[model samples]
Target: MTKNEWEQDLEQRELEKKAHNRGYRAGVKTEGEASKRVELLENVLLEFVGYDDKCLQTKPGLLKRKRADLVDQIIYQRQLMRELYNHLDDDVRLKLRTKVESHIWPVTHSED
Candidate 1:
């Protein structure tokens, strides 16, 4: 083979080898188990949120629930805004804006 052909073949083999290793690692991690799904989720969350084992142990339920609640609140606010834009009058919109800002601003701006 020419030098260019030989280099191309070598690069193709290296790419295939990397793909195979990734597939093998994924198979090992999964293993067709329900518990493995939960463990994988925890691992991902720990890495994403930078949380340590001690924090998870101390307030696991509270921490998870708070994260979920924040997500739900964001969804609800989006839906409410969409509805208000199409349906609500200025008076109703002003009242809702005032009420939501009063309840939300303090919690969101706290020192903690």
Candidate 2:
């Protein structure tokens, strides 16, 4: 390719790379938020259940509904996490894994 063509190609590649990185960062942020929600829901459920275990012991079917809602949140979080992993680049996934292994537990990785 000509020099101008080469430069144009290089610029395009850079743009693509930037876009991919942005997507990865956004995914990480999404997963982080969902994970936090899951944790919060778990804590709340634990406290509620601590008050009473059985439906009769608890506040009627409210606890059950709450439990089900929490479960749905957990499932949604899992799906979001899976979607993130599926769309993200391998290198970005590795970075996320590294964060996991380091015990840093990133709250967000969004560029903004």
Candidate 3:
């Protein structure tokens, strides 16, 4: 084989190796699973808001519902983080929460 053909083959092999190591094969999440996840997130956020608003209430049903929502949210959030962290560098994953929170609501120091 010519030098150009040999170089192309080496580059192709390297690309394949990287793709295999990264688990980039198709069919990760099905459509139904994605939809269910979205529904769970919405329910969790709604329940959380309700819980925050009714902090004075002691209704058992509401409390149970809120607890269930929170559990689902935590599970889904952890799954998402795991999937994201798999593709991101360790440092970025480690600082993800801090960076997101700081960007959303930066702290303001007042002079006393």
Candidate 4:
């Protein structure tokens, strides 16, 4: 092939590759944003549960009901987090799992 034809072919291939990469990156970004939203929701739920638990602890009469509510909220949050993990790409989910494990595992295992 002529030098011009070779250059044109190379340019076309490069453009196609760039487009493919852009689409892939956009997908990754969308998944990342969704994962972040889920994490934010989980944090909010945890904070609300913590506050509710503290409030209930201050009021003896409502303690049992509040404890049940807190447990339900925690379970819901965990389910949401799991769903988010399933939706994310493998690498993103792995990173999130690592972060959550590092921050939450010790506290979960620690005795008060």
The TM-score values for the models, in the order shown, are 0.31, 0.45, 0.28, 0.38
Better of 1 and 4 by TM-score: 4
Residue runs of model 4 more than 4 Å from their true location after superposition: 48-112
Write one digit per residue (lDDT tens) for candidate 3, span 44-64.
555545666554333664465
lDDT of each: 0.65, 0.70, 0.66, 0.70
lDDT of 2 by residue, 9-108 (tens): 9999999999999999999999987876776566455654455454222455446555756576567657666876889999999987877755654445
In candidate 3, what residue range of length 10 has the lowest lDDT sum? 103-112
lDDT for predicted candidate 1 compared with the true structure: 0.65
lDDT of 1 by residue, 2-31 (tens): 999999999999999999999998887777
- For model 4, the local distance difference test gives 0.70
**lDDT by residue (tens digit), candidate 4, 47-75:** 55666665333345335444645565567
lDDT at position 22, candidate 1: 100
Provide the lowest-lDDT 10-residue window in model 1.
32-41
Error of 4 at 9 (Å): 0.9
Cα error of candidate 2 at position 31, Å: 0.5
lDDT of 2 at 71: 76
